[model samples]
Target chain A: MNMSISEIEHEIIEEFGVFENWVDKYDYLIDLGKSIPKINPIYKTDENTISGCQSQVWLHAKCENSVIVFTADSDAIMTKGIVALLIRVLSNQKPEKILDAKLDFIAKIGLEEQLSQTRATGLSSMIKQMKIYAFAFKEKL
Target chain B: MSNKNNIQSLFPILKSSVNNNKLVYLDNAATTQKPNSVIAEINKFYLKENSNIHRGVHHLSQVATKKYENSRLVTQNFINARHSHEIIFTKGTTDSINLLASSFGQLLKKGDEIIISEMEHHSNMVPWQMCCERSGAKLKIIPCNKIGELDLDMFNQLISNKTKIVSVTHISNSLGTINPIRKIIEISHQKNVQVIIDGAQAAAHVKLDMQKLDADFYCFSAHKLYGPTGVGVLYGKENLLNLLPPYQGGGEMIKDVSLLKTTYADLPHKFEAGTPNIAGVIAFKKSLDFITETGLGNIKTHEDKLLDYATEKLNSIKGLKIIGTSSDKSAIISFIIQDIHHYDLGLLLDKMGVAIRTGHHCTQPIMKKFKISGTSRISFAYYNTIEEIDHLILAINKAIKMLS
Candidate 1:
């Protein structure tokens, strides 16, 4: 059976809770970043890019079998790692479900600072874009 | 204990911690941490002498006016300007440049050229570009070579009869390359072209003498020199200041007003239109006193040592490339690793309680010249210690290892 959005978020929080220090937490993030599949270069266009970030981030989303899948990339590995965590929580879910998801796991995992608009990572923008995609897909249905 | 310890102790923020670790602030170029004296002076202003300056006949007004004017005098002596009246209070370096551009652009005509270097901060560049757009004038750039030094030979050629002004930074904020302003002034003056020196980066690092430099105008922000924000100085030649139109017309800047016509005030006052940052300006004097008591020469010597030491240590790291390699530099280093991005490095460093600036350093043109997006930069002030540098190196190494 497919897990709910909160279930996935809970799973992530539990996985991150194992780390004792910031270094280990960041190390795990870096590993998650490395494990994420490479996004297609074809989808990496200026239209897909997000501004207001120190590092360049390209986010692309498409609906498959009424489920949304998010693909994203960043020049900075730390940002890429954060993006990986976000995509893992939001992707492979229904568009309506994705749109309704609160995704509070970011704050629970102590990554709330990255959600600040002023942060260089632009993780907040990435999350916003994911929801925007869900909303657009939801409208079509 | 060394005098450095005493100086560091004066800044209470230096003793603070971040993220469960000691905060090693290396972002002095953005803004220096305030000292106890400057902070106290600001507090004392609000507590004792809080009033609008230059207008009221009340006793508090006179006291506020005197303190504000006294700060201008302190700034005049700080930079060794010709007269106190020549020093106009501004918001900061960017505001000073914008004022100059708006007023000075009035003198320009079609086809008139304004020369600037590639390494100018956006503060210096954007204002001139706006002025050029307004006046139908052309902007000329003095190219920076691979090593981040301005091509002086090309600078000589860029100057022409059409060139009205040549503006350059005293010390580059991103690269830390110290431009030869004396030579630039001499060259521009011979051609009857006025020069404006952006002394924002140099004010804290160098001893400025406006007479010796003979630059027509010099601008610097007080915040960079351990003073409060929202306060800066624009020092212009007295006669030249008299010629340009007032930047803004308001209560303090006017001599007399009638229904028919209005006349402006004298040099300094004519430019300081509205009620200025009274508390910040008054507090700035204490910062000047702090710098004077500590000694600029001693600060320079200490910072130079830190720069050299940090440079040596940073060079040893594998895959790290320093962007600015100029022999003459302030206590700043901008570098990028082979694989690790600056954003990643900066985030990890912050987690370890190290604060360093990352990205374009507001000189996107310099980044473009180098064909890179941005760099991780660390700038040092007098209060920074060698131990802090070691900590920064350790943090960087750990961050790199994790990323790898």
Candidate 2:
């Protein structure tokens, strides 16, 4: 099945909307983080580590067949859950689409306003790092 | 304990709510809630006497100078220092300790040693570490046991003629261990070594009688004692303070200024160079007065009851484990639940209106020694009540249920 970034974001927003409370939404997010594809141990070095994060978060991306594939992990479960949400929306998409995508699902999911200032900065850093990867992969092509 | 309600009422912020629920602030070890008296005193100082000290011949300057110097006298008496001039005001405990490190550090020879405890806050550890590096001196650490009590016997063994300074925390911010400071001081004195007590945590819980401990220097942040932030007191023995050079140089700290040469001012001012937090220091006198009126004995009694009650209640929870278990500990209760990340627990509990501190409490060595990432700390104050604690327990239970 093929989906655009907006469609994928809509699906995620709908899933998050199913939860009635913040706790339930958080539980779902944690579960999603648990399911996040493990970043290769070789790529978990400081080189791949994202700065400005409260927790140690490592993201690795590959441009496979002109579509970006993202994998990530974190020492903290909450941060890992957040990274998983990013991976779900941004991974396996074209470099141009990834770079240009609105990805307003973060706001729609109430994360931007809901998160602590520091954590929100961490979230943005992760997104920025992912897009940089997409731009680099596009450059290589 | 009978006037517990009266004591709580003195802090205006205590009446406020968090997330529509009554605020249960158990983060006193981090900082304390200011009494209305202290706040008003600071406000009055800004309104009535807002002039810089020791400069102009104006009336406001004279009044402000009188108030600031009087606060120093109050602090000297509060800490039982022999002379008021010994109390050098600083930005905070970190600034105070850093001052000692730089000033006293210059006196150190190449092969000298500086000793710090394993459970010291980063403020206590980092300054000495930097000083040692700068002076080419050796840095040593005193180890602690499983329950976070410093090993005095080991500490004594580490002391030698080369040991120039033994710096330690009077109370562990993360572990709640009220250190055997007097004994440490006694032993260090045997070696003729100077000891610096980081009283940042203990300044509120314990009465600081400097004469009793006999530490060469003692420093504490005023904010932790319900005074304003950005102001702290560093109390040094008069003779020792005289020997050490000035930490900073500015307007008030100089007696005479010349392009070729300058003469430094006397003690306290020599160390306090720039424009100090004038309002903060003056308001600190009110905080000390608030504590004195409340009576140290009463505060201790109230805090002990809270500690015991919280310990017993949290102990009953099956998966929860208290981190520091020393019998001689103070009013802090640090704990971690099985398989629950402290950040998650802290985040959820914060939403439920319970304000507790999570993470290493700026003591990574203690966390490393305990072999855990961090523990959530719930430190009590005289203003905290049993009902607020009940709210905390309920919030914790809710967090566990949601996360687990």
Best candidate according to lDDT: 1
Off by over 4 Å in 1: none
lDDT of 2 by residue, A1-141 (tens): 668889989999998888887778877877886888888999998888874323557888988888999999876677778889888889999999999987788889977643345542256677888889989989998
Off by over 4 Å in 2: A14-20, A38-47, A51-54, A101-104, A113-116, A119-122
- The two-chain DockQ for each candidate, comma-separated, is 0.81, 0.41
lDDT of 2 at B40: 98
Candidate by candidate, in order, the iRMS in Å equals: 0.9, 2.5
DockQ-based CAPRI category assigned to the predicted complex of candidate 1: high
* Candidate 1 chain B least-lDDT 10 residues: B1-10
Each candidate structure's TM-score, on Cα atoms with residue i matched to residue i, is 0.98, 0.95
Among all candidates shown, the one with the greatest DockQ: 1
For candidate 1, the lDDT comes to 0.91
- For each candidate, what is the lDDT? 0.91, 0.87
Q: Please name the candidate that would achieve the greatest TM-score relative to the true structure.
A: 1
Which digits, one per residue and each the tens of the lDDT, describe model 2 over residues B49-119?
A: 89989887999999999999999999999989999998999999999999999997889979999999999
Model 1, residue B214: distance off in Å is 0.3
